[model samples]
Target: MKLHTIDTGFFKLDGGAMFGVVPKAIWNKTNPADDKNLCTWAMRCLLIEDGKRLILIDTGIGNKQDEKFFSHYYLHGNATMDSSLAAKGFHRDDITDVFLTHLHFDHVGGAVIRDGEKLLPAFKNATYWSNRQHWEWAVNPNDREKASFLKDNILPIQQSGRLKFVSAQDGVSFTDDIKIKFAYGHTDAMMLPLINYKGKQVLYMADLLPSAGHVPLPYVMAYDMFPMKTLDERKIYWNEAVEQQYILYMEHDPVNECCTLQQTEKGIRIKDLFKLEEM
Candidate 1:
């Protein structure tokens, strides 16, 4: 199996929201914010080529939103989904599965595209993957999360009759070498892919662990539906990651593509940082 890092580019998010209760004075040292108090982050996605199936995890924020909407989050950078795929000698049509970690606009936005007056699935040949629980939660979103679950980025997959659900069971096998691990703190039933690659296990840290800077136990995000749940999940995952020596694939880390954790004097901290290709 071969894995490629698909970078859709970078976007800015409020530093406060990304770091939750962590004070700006602290998080600022690691992720400096711009004059607007927004920190730049990468919309990094992962592509797995296993046998006949080419699976993509997370579609990044797409380009269908209006100017006013996009003005909120400044999307920048030259790398696009198509360009990144082409660099790997592939195209959107070559994708066999799109495994969305969640239905948030930034994560699943590129799953659909605007075609005339209708919104349609971008990858015409790929089967979109989501879970039943997350599907229901996103479709009937709460007031707090409704803004992130845009209808334009979501409904089209189901409407196109290409959406499929993985079993909600934790540790369910998505493929012979890939397993799904569910986290409820970020949103309901957010699935993180655990794949066996090149004699090592790679864990796709969706929003569970957005960056290596968030390795501290208290560095939970304010956007999480349940911050305490996230703290608990992080403790479990961080310990397991250290014990199992898993390479964490960061989704929003602007600089680092991947990292490993080591038990530190304070807590689980970043041991080493490198790119996915370095594996």
Candidate 2:
């Protein structure tokens, strides 16, 4: 199996929200904020090439949103889903599967597109994968999260009759080399892909660990539905990553694509930072 980094460019989010209760004074050291207190973050995706399947995990915030909508996020950068796929010698139609961690706009928006009068699945030939729990949670979102779960980005896959659900059972195998690990704090049943590649285990850190700076405990995001649940989940995942020597593939880290954890004197912290290709 081969994995490729699919960069979908960067967007600015309020640093305070991203860092949660952590003081700007501390987080600023790593993810420095602009005058607006927003920090740039990457909408990094991953591509898995395993024989007949070409699975693209988490499409970034799409281009279909209007100017006013996009003006709020301050999206920037040269990399895009199409361009990134082209760079890898593939195209959207070539993807056999679109595995979404969750249905948050920034993560699943690119799964659908606006074509004239119709909103449709971006990858016409691919089956979109999401869990039943997450699918129900997103479509019927609460007030706090409704903003993040846009209907246009979602419903289309189901409308297209191409949406499929992965079993929410934790550690369920998505393929011979990929296993789905479920987390609920960030969003209900967010599925992280635990992939066995090149004699190493690479766990896709969806919203669980957005960046290297979030390695430390208590650095949870305000966007999480249940912050305390997130804290507990992190403790388990972080330790497992360290014990198993898992290379965490980050999705929102602006600079670092991957990181390894170490049980330091101060607790589990980043042992090293590198790109996916470095492995």
Candidate 3:
């Protein structure tokens, strides 16, 4: 199986919100926000080429939002979903599966696009994969998360009759190399894909660990509904990652694409940093 890093684009977000309780004095050294205090982040997606089945994991925030809506996030970057895929000699229709880690706008926005008056699947031929529990939670999001679950990004997949839910429970295997791990803290039933690639195991650390700076256990995001639950989830996942030597594939990290954990005296900390292609 061949794995390719598909960089959809980058956007700016409030650094304080991204790091939650962590002080900017610390996070700034790593992320370094702009004058507007917005930290640039990459909406990095992954394309899994396992034989003929071309699966694109987590489409980045699409370009359907209005100018006023986009003014808030400040989306900037030369790379886009279409151009990035074309660089690798493929197109959206070549994608057989759109595996969404969660329903957040930045993560699943590219799954659907606005086609004049109608909203439809960006990949008309692909089956959009999302868990049943996550599907329900996103469609009826609470006040705190409502903004992230945009109807334009989500509802269209179900409306297009291309959405599918995996019956496989938590820690369930999706394919011979890819396994789905569930984290509830970030959002309800956020599925992190643990993939085996080229004799190495790589965990797609969606929002659970958005960037390399988030490798430290206490660096949970304010956006997480249950921060306490996130702490526990991180402990469990980090321990396993350290033990198994998993290469974490970060989606939102602007500079660092991948990192690994080491058994530090304080706790598990980043042992090394590199891009996915470096591995």
Residue range 1-279, candidate 2, lDDT tens digits = 889999999999999999999999999999999999999999999999999999999999999999999999999999999999999999999999999999999999999999998999999899999999999999999999999999999998899999999899999999999999989899999999999999999999999999999989999999999999999999999999989999999999999999999998999999999999999
Question: lDDT of all predictions, in order shown?
Answer: 0.96, 0.96, 0.92
What lDDT does candidate 3 reach at residue 142?
A: 98
Cα lDDT tens digits for candidate 3, 1-279? 888999988999999999999999999999999998999999999999998799999999998889998899998989999999999999998999999999999998888888899998999889989999999999999999999999889898998899999854887988888999999999999999999898889999999999988988899999999999999999999999989999999999888889999997888998999988888
TM-score of 1: 0.99
Model 3 regions lying over 4 Å from their true place = none
lDDT of 1 by residue, 136-229 (tens): 9999999999999998999889999999999999999999999999999999999999999999999999999998789899999999999999
As for TM-score, the candidate ahead, 2 or 3, is: 2
lDDT of 2 at 202: 97
Compared with the true structure, model 2 gives a TM-score of 0.99
lDDT accuracy of residue 267 in candidate 3: 85
